[model samples]
Target: MPYDPPPELAGLSLAQIAEQVAARNLPPLDTWDPPETEHSGMRITADGRWFHRDSPITRPAMVRAFASLLRREDDGRYFLVTPHHKQAIDVEDAAFIAVDCKADGDALAFRLNTDELVLAGPHNPLRAQGDADTPAIYLSVRHGCEARLDRSTWLQLADIALADGGDLSVGSQGATFALRPA
Candidate 1:
């Protein structure tokens, strides 16, 4: 059988857990984060891995790769969430994967995979709404910097890019998403 902490500890103070862990008095399975702030969430795994939703969580002293889903609100603030970690990474630095527009008609029939980079110039409502204006940045393999990535990676990347001011057009043929610069 596995050992589980009491339910009360699920939302306990992060400071308390940290202090115990630092002092080596606790088993290091507890996690915490400040409340009322974006990315202020925490979780504890069955294996005793303490996770902080505000930042990347990995095995102690280990580097882990993470990805997230992004959505742009009408107010302009970007909303992002990830299963690996609740922390949000700036979209500007993140990469995106887009489908080939030339092959696909204007019906917004495209896909975004992970590990591919997506870049755009500035905001143009006309382009975002799929009017006469075209998005500053579309999907292309060249934009990926010659790196080959699986479909999953591209999708993950697209999820984050779209959350950060990225827009998608639903056309007769397919769907297309764009990442415009701030």
Candidate 2:
């Protein structure tokens, strides 16, 4: 969806704009379903890199702008949706990577590759796929999309993951999510 920024942001600094964008009120993606369109030039790599026509999108600002436009539909495909258009994009893994995370008191908040923030708790739980020795970590982003946690970030999260009996759990905000679902 096209964001018509509040007129007040016109004079803000880049950092300020980024902060606003990070916390901006987003349209309810669940409510949007425009007709599907095609755009084969855009691709999100396995490591969360964006490319256009086989060239890496090196500009961080442009990448962030594109990230804001992404939407994953129910069919397990990703798209860039606007009020008027919904165009397909290739996602090798996921659209974003959970690069790092920090704690707000006991609440864990993750920082995705897009710089979007998500807290891990009951609403946005952490998940582990495959065997514990080598697993894929994922954090729910929004809607039905998710961000895969890179090994370093997943290890960081593991450090804080609480041990409950034989299961690994992430305890925050009075809830605990077992990494290996019980």
Candidate 3:
């Protein structure tokens, strides 16, 4: 079935519709899903070495950048990174750290270190896991760049970051910019 506009949006202008979409301020849809993930902690090596660990590891020199990182793409997705943690854990050698994300309302946490990617979900006790292979870092850009995020633009960013020996992180922190294509 075709989607019909809600009564509240019936008389809105194209610009208004666009604005609401950009701000994520539109009325909740019948199928909205609540955000189900959060970050608990992260660790990076002091000497900038990446390793994998199975327990809580510490690195003191890795500092959280104060300003948020924003990466605007030509398509319509924004990549943003901000300092959301209270304390920045230090990473040295192969060590592990924890990260918490919301899942089904409860906190789903995991421990990620040099090589391991642990995903904890509220629904299951057995941790869903993976490997980082390489450390994922966050970067941000200016709000003005929001006009450039799109599929092609994001692909370009991914290409550039990968070419520079970096891979895009999978979660919202790794890519938190909003889409505001022109």
Would you estimate the TM-scores of all the predictions?
0.26, 0.79, 0.16
Cα lDDT computed for each candidate against the true fold: 0.30, 0.73, 0.28
lDDT for model 1, on a 0 to 1 scale? 0.30
Residue-pair clashes, model 2:
0
List ranges where model 2 is wrong by over 4 Å: 1-22, 162-167
Residues 47-151, model 1: lDDT tens digits: 223346535465432211222233323343333333333343233321333432111122222222331222221221112222334323333322121112234
Query: What would you estimate as the lDDT of candidate 2?
Result: 0.73
Residues 1-182 of candidate 2: C-alpha lDDT, one tens digit per residue = 55342333224444444465468666766677788777858999999999999999997778877887788778898888877788889999877899876554556666787766677767777777878667788887776678999988877766766433444667766776666633
Better of 1 and 3 by lDDT: 1
lDDT, residue 131, model 1: 33
The superposed Cα distance between candidate 3 and the true structure at residue 170, in angstroms, equals 6.2
Error of 2 at 20 (Å): 7.6
- The residue-level lDDT of candidate 2 at 100 comes to 75
Off by over 4 Å in 3: 1-22, 31-151, 167-182
* Model 3 C-alpha lDDT per residue in residues 69-163, reported as the tens digit of each score: 32223443322233331222233421222221221112212212221122222221221122343222222112322111223333443454354
